[model samples]
Target: MDIVSVALKRYSTKAFDATKKLTAGEAEQLKTLLQYSPSSTNSQPWHFIVASTDEGKARVAKAASGTYVFNERKILDASHVVVFCAKTAMDDAGCSAWWIRKRPMAVSPPRTQKPLTTRVALSLPICTAKS
Candidate 1:
């Protein structure tokens, strides 16, 4: 489908059926999708916390209090809640950590090494700059 068509079909789930839950396979698929989602500069600086149990849902719902109270019911009734968190800034240490974690899976031709390093170096300031 084209981007416009997809956008037209997109929607927000205003309500959820509390009784229904995601199957293990469906949940795993969702997690895998999140893991492979693209990121700027290939810096996968994000974390996802999935809450599937009643207690976990309750804990997650707490954040919906006050101004966000309207979302509490949705959060509580959803079969699975995924909290997406991202880093506001990436420091040297954070970069090192990310590199270490991604090193094993990062495979590239020797010819691309210099350009890859340059790209990362250029993007670091943008990622780390405080807004």
Candidate 2:
């Protein structure tokens, strides 16, 4: 479909049918699509958590309930829920190396090695594991 059609159809869903679950294949496809989603600077600073099983969802539900108690059920019953997390700080975790490798201008001069600007996200995700 067209972008406009997709945009128009997109809306936040409040309720999900617990009985209806996404197949493994469908879940995989969703993950692949999210991975390829465009982001600023191609930093790919985002991490995702996919909860497809009851146990997995429960873990996510616990986190959601701590804050958004009403919205927790949406996560509990959804076929699959993806939690997107953005990295807050760049450290020796190879984030600087990654940026320097990807962007030539990010490198500092030989005379003076300067730290690269770090990107920070507002909130951290409770789940850090990838699907």
- The estimated TM-scores of all candidates read 0.76, 0.71
lDDT of 1: 0.79
Local accuracy of candidate 1 as per-residue lDDT tens digits, 47-82 = 999999999999999999899999999999999999
lDDT values for all models = 0.79, 0.69
* lDDT (Cα) of model 2: 0.69
lDDT of 2 at 21: 84
Q: Which regions of candidate 2 are displaced past 4 Å?
A: 100-131
Q: What TM-score quantifies how close candidate 2 is to the native fold?
A: 0.71
* Per-residue C-alpha lDDT of model 2 across residues 53-124, encoded as one tens digit per residue: 899988988887556899888988998988888875545445545556566775364544333322311121
Clash number for model 2? 0
Candidate with top TM-score is 1
How many steric clashes between backbone atoms does each model show? Answer: 0, 0
